[model samples]
Target: MIGKLGATTVAILLSGSVMAAAAERVEVFSTSGCGCCIGWIRHLEEAGFEVTNENLAMADLYAKKTGAGLKPGQTSCHTGFVGGYVVEGHVPATQVKRLLAEKPDAVGITVPDMPAGSPGMGESDEPYEVLLVARDGSTSVFARYPLAEDASR
Candidate 1:
């Protein structure tokens, strides 16, 4: 019984660690000079994401976004890819995790036009929306920020 219990405990611990590592990997593309993008990357890292980033020219970055199926209105300064989904803009890390958990059948999510008080955009009383962009370029509100509980953050 003791040996069986020990084996089960080890299996559980290893599975948790492996899953966390695999689930948190994200790849980002942005301009090297974009400070806000850097901050956003930091935000993901703080949320336990394993981030790998590449800097591109603005034109190249835009191309990358387009290639990722992000339309003009859905664009942001930086773009990220994780778990077969695209992430655009200053979207909160929590929302990203939620997206992964829900596994929506959409192209990805975006926070259009870097809103203040977003994950890396500093604090603000202004509210913002995270849009879930569909494969055909339609968007719907995926999440909203500055919730009553989040005001303290």
Candidate 2:
């Protein structure tokens, strides 16, 4: 009985470790000179993601985004991959977590061009949308953030 319990506990622990490791693994492709990109990375780190930063030309990143099925309007400054999904632009870490958790049927998510107040841009004067890029290349708003009337609100 003791041996069986030990084996089950070990299995549970291993599964938990695997899930944690998978959650932390994120590969980011961006330019070395982009401060906002770094800021976004920091946001991910704060949200418990382990980042693997790769220095690539802007063109390369764009190519990867396009290759990953991101349309022109459905792209941002940086590109990331985790759990077989492409993460584009300055998408919030919470959204990213939700993406992993929900495992939606689509290409992945994008914040389009770097939007203000979207995790790394500080404050946004206008609303922004996080788009869900479908496998067929159609995009729809997955998440919308409305700017507060007070500007700082």
Candidate 3:
């Protein structure tokens, strides 16, 4: 009975961790004139993220992205911080949740260049990749999109 109880408790804790990640608080920095950034924030909110949007001037927003260690090629209109990870550009909320759950040993993930089919940009036949940025600024393909199913949406 004690062993069964222990197992159940562990399962509960694991499930709770996933729930926490899904509902994590995200802080976003973007320019006041960016409608796309607002759309991205709405995407996060709809996905259960607690979003705090801080609209800065373009210069200040650029500084925040640079300070977060995002290179020119890795940048987008908005930047987000969550669970100590820097989320750049139009990264989907599912990838953000996965990052929090996996707790990778890196900076964060980025969509880069604002792909047309990305969450904020709406649907398209064009595909895009989400890159996981390392501490040294190198990136790897973390996720790819415009799958057969996704392209329809």
lDDT of 1 by residue, 43-148 (tens): 9998889999999999999998999899888988999999889999999888899899899999999999899989778878788899999999999998887778
TM-score of candidate 2 on Cα atoms, chains taken together = 0.86
Model 2 lDDT tens row, 13-76: 8899898788658999998888988988998998889999898877887788888888888877
lDDT of 3 by residue, 17-94 (tens): 887765599999988878888889999888888999998999999999889888889999999999899999999888
**Whole-structure CA lDDT of model 1:** 0.89
| Error of model 3, residue 37, in angstroms | 0.8
Q: Count the backbone clashes (under 3 Å) in each candidate.
A: 0, 0, 0
Q: Give Cα-based local distance difference scores for all models.
A: 0.89, 0.83, 0.87
Residue 121's lDDT in candidate 2? 82
Better of 1 and 3 by TM-score: 1
Clashing pairs in 3: none
* Candidate 1, position 64, lDDT: 85
TM-score of each: 0.88, 0.86, 0.83
